[model samples]
Each structure stands twice: as C-alpha cells, then as structure tokens.
Target: MPLPDPSLLFRPLRKLYRRLPLPYALRVLLGRIYRRIGSPVNRAIQQRILANSLFRPPHCHLQESLDSLPDYLFWGVIDWDFRHQRPQHLAEQLSLGGRRVFYISSTLQDDPRAGFALRPLDQTGRLFEVRLFARTAPIIYHIAPDATLACQLRRSIGELLSWANTHQVVSLIQHPFWTPVAGVLPNSRVVYDCMDLHQGFGNNAVELQDLERNLIGAADLTLFASAWLEQHWHQQIPRTPAQQWAVLRNAADFDYFSKPAQHPCQAPDQGPVIGYYGALAHWFDVELLAAIAEAFPHCTILLIGADTARIGARLRHHTNVRLTGEVPYRQLSAYLHAFDVCILPFRIESLTMATNPVKVYEYLSAGKPVVTVDLPELHEFQQQVTIAKDQQAFIDAIARALQAPASSAESRQRQAFAAQQTWQHRVQALLALTEGTQQQPRVSVIVVTYNNLAFTRDCLASLTADPQGQPLEIIVVDNGSSDGSVEFLQQWATSYGQTLILNDSNRGFAAANNQGLALARGEFLALLNNDTQVTAGWARTLRRHLQRNPGLGLIGAVTNNIGNEAKIDIHYQNSQEMAVRARQYTWRHAGLIVPCATLGFFAVMMPRSTYERVGPLDEAFGLGFFEDDDYCRRVEQAGLSCAFAEDVFIHHHLSASFAQMPGKQRQLLFERNKALYEAKWGRPWTPHVAREKP
Candidate 1:
C-alpha cells in the first residue's frame, strides 16, 4: 500500500497542459509576467537594487557629437520580439557607425541595444527625473506614434525634432507601413525598407500598398532585404540613379549556429535521431516530417521547442518521435548534441523561398550534418548541407547524414562556415544603411478568412493585442461564409473599422485574396489564414524578417502541425482508421508535420506588389488544395523566392471542418484536384514527388 508515485499521477496532466488552448497561452504569459514583476523573489531583488540605488531605469540620452553625423532611424519591431532576425541585430550593427545616432521609437526599453530601460514618470510630466542615461552613441526614443493620442505624440515629436534640428540627423529609416507618416517627419531625408509583401493578409492589408508607394517616393534612399523586393521596386521606379535599393541578404549567427557539441551524444533508445529545432509553424513541411518519421520507424524524431498543439493532432501515432518542449537558450546545445542529423522540412512557397533561416546557422554550428528541402534561402549552404529536391530526396539526405562518420573534421568545417555569419555582422550592415535618415515606420497586416470563425477570431485577437505600438491596420476578407462568420467579423469590425469586405458566396482562395490585395494601403501587407492561431510577436517576426531581406517574395509564420513530422499514416481505408490515425499521429508528432500533399491553409504573408505581378491564387483550384502549390509555382517562375519564419507559429487544427464531410465527396475532390494538378504540372498527385520526376 505504498503511495502512488507523484510522477505517474502528474504525467497525464503534463500531457494535457501541452495541449492547452490559446487562452491558456495568454494566461501562462500573464502568470509569468506577474511572477517576474510581482513575485516575492523578484520583489526582493528589486528592493535590494533600490536600497543600493542600483535600480536605474532605461534611458535614451543625447551625448557629444562626433565628426560623423548621426542618422534618424525609424526602427520597427526591435527589442521585444524574439525572432532570429530582429531590429536588435540591426541596432547592434548600427552602433558601429562611430557617430551620434538618434532613434525615434516607442517604449525603447525593449531593445537591449538601447542600453537603457525606462523608469516611471513623475507628476507634471517633465519626461525623466534626471534618469536620462546614454549609450556609446545616442538612440533617442519619443514614444512611437499611433492613432490613439496624436497631440501627445506631436508634442513629443516637436521636442525630439528640436533636438534633431540642433544635431545633424543624417537620414530617416522606416518600415514600409510608416511611409504615410514618414513623409510628415520634419527631416528632409527619408529611406524606405521594403521588407515583405504585405497586402495578401486577410483583413489588415488595406493601407499597405498606398503607404509603400508614398514611402518609396518620399525616400532619399531605398533598401530591401530580399532580391524580389529590390527587383519589384526597381521595375516600378523609373531608372533613377539616386534610388539606392540594395538587397541586404539575410545572414546567420554563425558563432551561435556553427559550433559543434562539446560532448559525445546519443539518440533516444528507440532509433536514430532525425530532428527539427525551432518554431513549428504553418509553413513547415509537416507532411514531410511525418512521412519521414513513418518511412523510417527505426528513427527517433526529436522536435525541440514549444508544443504546437492544434497542428500536432495530425501526428499522434508514432512512438518513435517525441516533442521536448521549449528549452532555455543555454540548454539548446545539449538537445542539438542528441540529434545525429538536423532537418529543415518546410513547405515551399513565395514566403519560404525568400527566407534566410537562422536554424541553418545553428545546425551548421552544431556540426550536425543537415538535410532540408530545396529552399532558395538555403541555396548558399547547399555545399555544406544536403538540399533535398523532393520527399524521397529529403529522406535520402537524412540517411546520408546519419550514415556519415561522426568525424571531427566534418564538424569543424561546419563550425568554420558558421563562424563567418554572426548576428553582429548583419547588424553592422543595417547601421551602415540607416546612417542618415528620419522616417517613421508603419506596417499593415492583411488577413483573409473564408469561413473559419473560431480560428479567424484568434488571429484577429492577437493583432489587436500586439505589444508594439506601431501604426497597424487590419484588412479582413470574409469570402461568403455561411457559418455566421460574417456576423462575428462585423462585430469585430465595429471596433477596428478600417476595411472589411464580405463577399457573396466563396470566391475561391486566390480571388478572395485578390479582393483583400486590392484594398491594401500600407507599405507592407501580411497575408494570413483564418484557420490558424498565432503566437506572440508573430507580426513583428514576419516584419523584421521582410525588413531585413527585401529580396524575399513572401514570408510565412511557423505552424504547430504543418507538413509532416510524424509517422502516423493517414491513408485511412475507413472512418475507424482515420480516427485511429488521428489519435496516434496527434500524440506522436505533437509539434511536427503529419504528412500533407502541400502546406495547409494556415498562414502566409507577403508584400502587396507581389500580388500585382503574380496576380492572385489560381481560382481554378477553387476551394482549397493545390492553390498554394500553384501560387508557389508562380512565385518561383517570377524569380522571387519564399521564406519561412523560425520564431512565430500558428496553431492549426488540420482539416477539422472537413472532418464531417462525406468521405466520397472528399475522395472525389481529391481525385478531381489531382487530375487538375496533373494536367497543370504534368504529374499525378502523390504523397511523395519521386514518382513525378523519376
């Protein structure tokens, strides 16, 4: 009669927590915030600091000027957001300018490079109570502007401009969305950073296109992170010698990513380790991950990061895979050590092709041989890593990496390659570009919802609740949903009235997106899915990535249950099989992909202009499936690339609404679509692309 072990009693609870809902995610966040800011332990530390007079607040001070002039930077989404490529990387690099710099941002305490945190204001609002601190250079913060209180911002701006008037504010650098306001800045010079194609977003993309044009016209200089951005803009603008649009290719943190594990490691007991580390989002090739795990039952697939619950439902069966929820940055080394081979199984699209994955650098740093789908972003690392052309090729590459001798030389080569691409270097380039400009940054997000009311509500809620105070608008397109979705959206629109379109009957994915795209007025447009739940800083993550790489055609958020990361077979012969597979795969590959023919209807973001050229998603595909593929094909054909974000992920419950549909109908659609796809691409649809090529 010994007491039951606590571990056994709590195991099921822990699993339940792993599958917590969106509200739970927020509750957890609030709890953490409370603990950090209110808990006795934190209070004690603060008390100690106050007693010792060490509790200094964040500062944004102006210092002595140097020979070189400081620039006016309208930085967007810098410090608070935790993505691979954020504004901090740019700030750190810009600090290298060796000149006095002035920053016009909100809060300003979020970025570490700000080198200061803000303190509470005293009565009479004299700004700081002599708490103004300084960095190596100056990064002034006059809280970011928004629609709520223009008078207060104007006063703050007047003071900030008075200071800028005295000092030589070299240039104004701003994100595309802020173009409309960047023109209002007192400073004469302006620079536009076209990061992503933003208009395709479902709801908030109305102002992006107009904003981008204004920003481009107002800018003395223009720069882009992705090749597609530069090309797209360059084509639009008549050949002007003064136009300085450069493709600031996305770089990796080689130092952190290129090193090898210091200790010998072993995989889990069941099989060889094939793993993916980073955010598991909608753009991930979840299908590939699940298929690979299934194809090789002898392998243990490890996903090291936060649990992606809704998406994980697709991969519950595989006993060979396990999701080790988010680990501390310091502890990541140990997990990478356990992986024999790293994987970059991702959905190919306009968003993914233009991306520069940070994990690529981390994988190389770990000195673990890598296997990934052929993404344009990874084209540079093809020599050092294996680029899989299709599902079979992806599997083959994993096999090759696993079979390779775990030699130190191979490891060293990876580390050496990684050493060259540090976050510091990327930062330096940003500093160089924004040396002299004064432009405010604004962003517009376009989200498209067809009929998924619950999912769309979640997505819209996240945007409205974003911590960043930057000017943002949401353009939502409701494509004739009969599920009372229109009513729900109309209610939301009452509060967030900008642009909301309700179509009569479903107009297909492309046409609905086109409808949204037509109304985009921001400098950038972010296309999102109605069936997905986004994570913290999802918009900022996508924004920063696109900002850093203008050459990108599209960018996407990570999804919890994307492609295929589990081994649970979904080729169900009957409803029973489907249910069993669902249960099994859902448990097995909680954060990995469950095999899919293509990336699902979760999330994708791009600029407004890309749509102008690529047109809209092919309407012929109709409701769903193959539409994204056809769009991706158009992107590739257009020479613009797609990229996947490693930071943000949306929780997507795969084919949930379709679950109740008649099996015959689904089969018919599948066959019809397969035939249509084969007619278009000259190949029958299959789980793997081997049959088509070989």
Candidate 2:
C-alpha cells in the first residue's frame, strides 16, 4: 500500500469542526472569529491616534529610550476598590535611580489626567485618587475590579493613549478585562502585570480563564504577583529576550505602615486583635479561620471587608471576635492602629496556590505582627512575617504576635525589612532574571538588512561597541537591501571582511540565518534585527547563561517594541505589517525563556550543534513568525532549553521589513506558513511551549 501524503492527513482534519462534537467545534470557530475581528480593529485605532504623536520625535534614538527608562519602575493595579492603594514597600524598590510609574488605573489624587478612575464598590469620595507626585519618575497604582470591564473601558479610552506618549516606561497591571487593551499599546511598551491566578475567580471564572490565557499570550512582559502565578505564567508567557515573566509579588509599603502605634481602645482590653481584612470569599479558608477562632477563645478576632457570608455564622457569634463590616480605606490605619496582630487565613484553593495577597503587603506596611498559612509565594517574605504551618501552629503564632510589644527598634526593623522589598529592587531582579555572567563567550552576531540605511548604520555601531566583546565576529546578512547596505558592507569589509556576508536577495529570516550559520565559527550564534541597537554587554550576558546551563540551546534578550519579554504576541502576524513599523517606539523591562513554538529569526542565539541537529529554521517559514519557535521546539525535544537573558537588551523598531508589504499579501504568506508549521509540529503554536530551562 502507498503511504498517505502528510499534507492530505491535515486536509481531512481541517474538517474537524464539521465532524467533531458541537461544543469543541464551536470553541475552535469562535476563537478564530474573535482574533480576526478584534486584533486588526484595535491595532488600526491605536495607530491612527498615535501616528503624529510627539513621543515619536524625529530626533529620538534607540539608545535614548534604553537609557531613559531609569532602569527600574515599581508597579501595581487594584482588583477591588479596597485593595487599590499603592504598595509602598514595592515602590521602595525604585529608590536606586529616578524611578517612573504609569497607572492604567490608580488611587493617587495629586494628578487627574495621569490616573484613570476606577468604578468603585463605593463611588463616594473623589471616585479614585490620581496622584502624579514622583519628582523624576512617577508610580501608577491602577485598580480594576473586573478585567473584562476594563477592556471595554480601555477601548473607550483608547485615544487617551496619546497621554502616555511622553512617558518613559509603561506597565499595565492587567486584570482580565484589560487583555485587549493591554495587548495593543500603539506607542508604549506594555507589561501584562500578571499578579494573581486569574482563573480562580469562581464567578468570573470562565472569563478569568480566557483572560489569563490572553494576557499570557498578549503582554510584552508579565509581573506575577505571587510565586504560584510566576510559575504558572512561566508556563504561559515564557521567559525569553522576546518575552519576559517576572515575580514581583505583593510588596510591603515601608515607613508609612511601619510606624509604631498604640492598640485601639475600641476593642475591649483583650488578648490581641487577630485580624484578617480584604475581600472574603471562597479563597478565605472558612474552616481554618473558625478552627483558629474557636480553638483559641481568649484571643480577640477581627474580620474586615464585605462578603463574609461564605464563612459560617457560628464563628461570628464568638464574644471575643467582631466583624468590623467593611471599613473605609481612610479608617484602615485607625483600625490597624489598634491591632495587635494580623492574620492571612487563606484556603489552599487555586487562588491561594498562586496568589500574592495584597493584604500581606498591607499588614507588613502597618508594621502589625503578621501570622498566616504558609504559601510558596510568601517564602521570600517569611523572614519578615510570622508564618503558620497548620491550625495549631497558627494559634501559637497569633499568641506570639500578641505578646510582642510595639518598639521603635522593631518598627525600624520592620521599616528596614520593608525597604528591601521595593519595586526598584523587584525591577532590578526582573532585569537580571536571566542568570548570565559578565564574562563574554564565543559569539557570532549576524545582522540582516534590506534597506533603512540610517538604522543599519546605528545597529552596526552598537554591535561594534558591544560591552561583552567576547571575541566578536559581526556578519551583515545583506538580504538584497537596495540602499547603501551593499556599498556600506563593502566599505566596512575592507576592515571587517572576516565578519560580513553580503547575500543577494531577501531569502527570508531562515535562509539568511542558515547562510550566516554556515560560516559561524563561534560556539554561539546571534540572529539580530538590523533595526535594533544593542546595549552594553548584551551578548556576553546571554553567552554566560547558555554556557553555564548546558541544556540551554537558545537564549533571547529584552528589546523595545518586540512585545514584553514575558508574554507572547496574541496579535502575532506573519505578514510584514506585523513587524514593528520604523516610526513606532516602546520600552521593555525584563527577559524570559520562551517555551512555545516561535518564529525567532529577529533576535536569538543558538549553538552550532542546535543548527546541525534541529536542521536550519524551516525555510518554508518564509519571511516571519514560527520558524524560531519550531526550531526551539526541536531543540527542547532534543533535550535543550531556550532562555531569556533579562539583563541583556536591544532596541527594536517594529515591522521594518513587513511594514512595507501590502496587508493581504502579508496575510497570505503568514497563513500558508502557519499551516506548514502545524503540520510538522503536530500542534498549533500554543501559549506554552514545552521546555525545561537548564
């Protein structure tokens, strides 16, 4: 019998919608429908609004944006109105330099235009305070109750994006509703601030589930609020130069909450106020709270916030306890002013599993003694807060906190502790997420150019000045660049011949990379974008990590306008239109490893062995998207991993090549190539690319 043609096999499966069960088929159809309708419309609107903006000043240079972002920025957005306050402890991380912040939603009051208003549970006072107080860099504490709602609001307010034109750094503290808007920032580099396990919102569970996936696939970088979220997002967004996912966690606000205070007189002189505040729902370990409250009758307990109905009323009857019934944010300090201890009685549900409790930061901010159930995300903060192993241990911890006296030294110690957990510190940690050393490794840097004379010159200058300087070999892959590239390469070749490869046509990313790879003598080869300018020591940092982690086959770095280094481009298009337009500019902060199948011809590195084993990036990938991802998958399948070197960075101007192509032509090539990629991989490019970082 003759073997079946592989292409024919997929031809039949393409009818899965007609043959499969209704629900599964509907899901597939709906997804493609949404992407088609939503993506282009949003992109067009953002482009039109930002077209002539001042942010893209003619004199702006790639190096200038990299240097202007202040290296770090602290950030957070609110999910509920009460949790909407600025996390001061996290903010302290930005003290190293002039820090800057942008809130898609916030409670700061000093500035209105800078802060977006949130639909409050109580729309009572000032709606939401919008503050623009930072002298050099500002902090935006954007809060959104429902991310679904936020997306719609963002579209309504989409034109206001021009306001962000002048800002150096833009971080989107994404709630589910923000995904659509979060994905399309015409003028700003967006960070899909993934701070929690979004799918755990039981009522908003379905929407949350979809939103979580969208944010992971869309945002440029994701800042997980908790370790659980971080690990989860690592699987979703991936960590690579093209994407970034970092764990910033809910951090404490020092000094403001660390001041020593006397206990409140409202509570009958009791043992201690074992308080747990914020939203109360399924995530609240009802049995645990009851067990602790009932097990220890002498301790005075306080429960704050609405939605305490989920916890049984029997626990409410205790004479030693009081439900303060949703206190105002203004009165929170007063309530904490009287508290002896604070507790986080969380249930080990999916939410808790990946949550970085905002109250944890609040409790620490208040300098109140804290005791709570142990969680992986809190392990870093364990030293500062009192952690309980179980019910019995929780009771014991509460007793210890109550007995402890408020002291100046203790307050100073708490403040000191809070100081270490600032957003700047988190940003630094984020920037250095990829563990690569300063020592340079053998590197072959390849730049592919078609036109754009000015961009190619700057990119070359940057490559020549690379700080790592690891026995450098620079090869300019001239893919039929009509302008001065050929002449320029020849002139530079008299001095740099050992490094240049002048190709005749635009043989696409894969073919050109293959051509460059054929001549690469270095252990590691870099496929750089011609429109991009490298920062100091960028190559050395990527080389060090790939060298130390033997299992690593590919490494990517943070770059401007290539989406955040944490999340995939949900709006990813293969056509030239998808590339970063020459006029567009944005900022990126971190780096991470990409596990999904990707087209990484732009800025990536691979060992020569990888090229030999996985074979060159599929030439069928033509000009863009999926080639690098497919190659990386083959590498991972071969027992190697891809890495994102956060510290190493480059500035990429979007869509330099594809930008010149007509829309339909670009779309046709993308679809045809996408079908080919799926045929070889046995799966469409998913949010999670199977990978294990060495």
Error of 1 at 199 (Å): 4.0
| Candidate 1 structure quality by residue, lDDT tens digits, 244-283 | 6666655555555445557634665656788887776666
RMSD of each: 28.4, 17.4
TM-score of predicted structure 1: 0.46
**TM match of model 2 to true structure:** 0.49
On residues 1-694, what C-alpha lDDT tens digit does candidate 2 reach at each position?
A: 2323334434564576457667877778766874797555554444444333322212111111232342222233452344534343333233223333333343232211222333211222111122221111222222222543333333323322222232223435455544444443322344566666655664343544565676566455666777677766666544545456666665544444555445443666456567777887767877777777786688777787876555636566666667767776656666776777888888776778787776776677666677888887777777678778888898888777667777646645655677776555565665454222322246888777788888888878777753224357877788888887788877876775556777777888778877877777887888888887765446655664465467778877645466434323223243232222111212221222344234344678777677667776678788876676678778888887776654344566767888878999999987887788889988875643323224
Q: Compute the lDDT for candidate 1.
A: 0.57
**Candidate 2 CA-lDDT value:** 0.57
TM-scores, one per candidate = 0.46, 0.49
Query: lDDT scores for all predictions?
Result: 0.57, 0.57
In model 1, which regions exceed 4 Å deviation? Answer: 1-74, 78-81, 96-174, 187-189, 200-204, 235-239, 260-271, 305-309, 325-334, 408-410, 427-694
